[model samples]
Target: MENYMMSGEGEKNSSDVVYLCDEVFDFSTVSSAFFILIFILSVTGNVLLLFVLAIYEDLKNITNLFILNLACSDLVFTVTLPFWAAYYLHHWIFGDFTCKFMTAAYFVGLYSSVILLTAMTVDRFITVVLHNWWSSPVRRRRYAMAACAAAWVISIAASVSDAIKVEVETSWNNLSTCEAPSDGPDIKLGYYLQVSLLFFLPFVIIVFCYSAILKTVLQATNRKRYRTVVVVLCIVAAFFICWGPYNVLLFVMSMYDPRGCNEIERLYIAHSICRILAFFHCCMNPVLYLLSQKLRTHLLQLLHCKCVRIKCKERGTATTVIQNVAFIAQNSAVTLDPHSK
Candidate 1:
């Protein structure tokens, strides 16, 4: 799609970019299916995760705090997805405030998740790889919270500026859009910051952590060490699988566009596909994190209680059903080691 003009300005430029690219492919079919599926999975997974955390575990632990923060970040992205889905089919009609808020929230989700995941890896590094120097419990929790706060502040500051600059654009046939216009320096800076903070630095930390963990676990006698390595690897893999290609592709595009129109078209199409793939990371968090053995035990107990309740109902034992529900709720409580990473 071609476009141009300031908000409510006079005639727009006959040719304009949609989504910072030369052309906007009609990706409604591709977008609609993926967005809806992601929305459902992300919502269900994150919500279940939040519920499990609130009911079964205390958030006072530093590790749980990071997990909670990550889930909230995923939820931030998930909540705004419907609007984006609508925007894909019909351009952004949600007005300026919503355009800014939703777009910024999307960045918050992306940036914050990367940051938190990085933070989690760092914590694990200290706790596992350098256990001898691990600090006091109180100090560890305080420092973890401080790290989380720093990440939030940085991610928001980096992302919110460009998001706020987003204004509605009227494209062909008067369809409105929420793209931020490209200013060469600003876009280059945004892309640089995004690739650096949101992907590169975090990726390095995660890899270092797992590498260190691998060396230690291989030497250690702890049975749980291998399990920790496996889970951490799954997480690191998920992060890269979802965000890696998109980050690399965008960074390259930002650096230089030697390609002609056809190449631009193909690159943007790949970008669109990467975006759809990246969004699925939000949903994967629950499966990867909350499905830990301890949480799984609680889930199985919950299911067992439901079965008992059903049998009690068949037996016409109203009191037993109530008792079963109470029993299940009590069983949900789990004590997680705060520094277990």
Candidate 2:
């Protein structure tokens, strides 16, 4: 009995001694710089998208409503990144509240993003495949708003779980780390489920939906086929390329943690790289959405109108030249009028 007790104590001591990687990269430099860049780009892009969707009366479609929510989610998520960047630099300097909030924001953004993407795909599918029943303007607007609300509720619940489970730990080196307890079985299970449901399942759905959409588009003979297919493919492919590795790496890390794994350093490095790729997703959506030909043309027309007004401030002569150029272009066969006649 004494021998067994002694062995148990020894095992406990071994487990209590936290092991950290020897060659952990000084990620502060790169992480800070990279996240700052992402924050600027994501905030600027998503906010501009939101503004465009809001102010542009012509863009007041159900699809734009969903996109507005998506941009809002991305904006909220990007706002939390600076905290993470600060953590990476100063080692989780924020208190427990911030830790919870920031972590929750991250997961919320993730869950919301996937849910919205899935919702968007389903919406498109219904509109395209069941146009008779699903394409009504009133019904589409109602459904899209409902879907957006449901996504927010689901994402909030998902993020709340993380807020509940996460705890801040201080290392011997005086660095505070936000993490779950080392032997937290419930937390581990929750983590696994969160990743699986929020990322893996949604990814499968997206792939399946996009594949079917592609097939359907190919079978049809619409003049808009090339543009529509390219846009959809770009969106789907960007999501897969940016987020896929992060999800895979997260699963691998979760698996390896419960079971003793070798080459910890390599896994850690891979995780860091995956995280960087994941961050790119926040900014990529705006570019994909805005770069669509329709949106670009609208933006250009707005800009040109604004430029014409601003140019009027320069001088009357320049204004007359501009008007004459416009008139001659409108009546291409006629020469520019020298006088009012």
Candidate 3:
């Protein structure tokens, strides 16, 4: 959890003395633990969701389809967590190839997740507000697929820009750090552009879509309007609550020059906390999606179906006996009727 600041050249400043407080904060320990927890829960939950979606034909709706892809992207990102955790723990042991790959995978997943969430919000908005102009299932499927593909393409391009500029340097303290080379202005420019495009733009889109959807729901005459409002509100609240601080911290760090800051150690501590909170976003969606009433009901029905099949196998003899008894009772009643005679 030690914070090491690099010069714009991507090299550790030899003249810069390591502060006493540097020994206290270990980002490796904190970030490693946080990523480990996120990796486990997000991978497990999203995988289970993917399995559920794949096995059940009826669950193949457009929303669920986008959700399935979202889970896949999350899972892919989560899979790279061990490398990061190792980096935090062993101080970037895997070398430059992995360094680039890890960073690329991370951004790719991050961007893809944002895009998917925005798409899901837009899909909901259309279904709720434009009921008359509904598109066919085929068109919806195509659009969802296209959105997913576009997210990946854009993410890859952003990641490559970072990868090309990023360098791994062993600091004076002998810790290996991966960061952008100092001489390149493109790196800083690229970083800022990424923040704007991947995070800020998508955030605005999500907020706008949800707002419109909320307004429409509020104006509806249906008794279920209140319930719909609550659902959309929960989504909006969660999105902001989990992501807002992280984005703020990123902006703060981007603006903060270690040379200018009076208390670098304090700022680093705050930044680390915000980063950990941001990681919470990875697993939050699965909780929201799985805990939703609609999704829960469907999951229950899926479980119930499995239970019924199991019971039928174990109690086949009892089932046969009950069927035979009913058949006999019906024949006996018909024989006694005068019309039957």
- TM-scores for every predicted model: 0.80, 0.82, 0.79
lDDT of 2 by residue, 59-108 (tens): 44766776788888888789888987787677778888888888788878
Sorted on TM-score, best first, the list reads 2, 1, 3
Tens digit of per-residue lDDT, candidate 3, span 1-341? 11234222222232355334333344557777998998888887777677667776354467667777777877877878888777767666777887777777877887787777777777777777776666687777788778878877877787776676556789787878766654345655766777787778878887887788778877878847445445544654676687688777766765555542335555666766776776776777677776567666666676688798888887997888999999999999999888995
Clashing residue pair totals per candidate (backbone < 3 A): 2, 0, 6
Cα lDDT for residue 186, model 1? Answer: 65
The list of candidate 1 runs beyond 4 A from truth reads 1-25, 256-261, 303-305, 312-341
Residue pairs with colliding backbones in model 3 are 1-25, 1-26, 1-27, 2-26, 8-182, 9-182
TM-score leader = 2
Cα lDDT tens digits for candidate 1, 102-175:
88788888888888888888887888888877668888898899989987888789667868677887867888
* Model 3 C-alpha RMSD to native: 5.6
Relative to the true structure, candidate 3 reaches a TM of 0.79
Model 2 reaches what TM-score against the true structure? Answer: 0.82
Per-residue lDDT, model 3, residue 296, is 69
Backbone clashes in model 1, listed as residue pairs: 1-24, 3-16
lDDT of 3 at 157: 81
After superposition, the stretches of candidate 3 with alpha carbons farther than 4 Å from their true spots are: 1-23, 57-60, 133-135, 172-174, 182-184, 223-237, 258-262, 298-309, 317-341
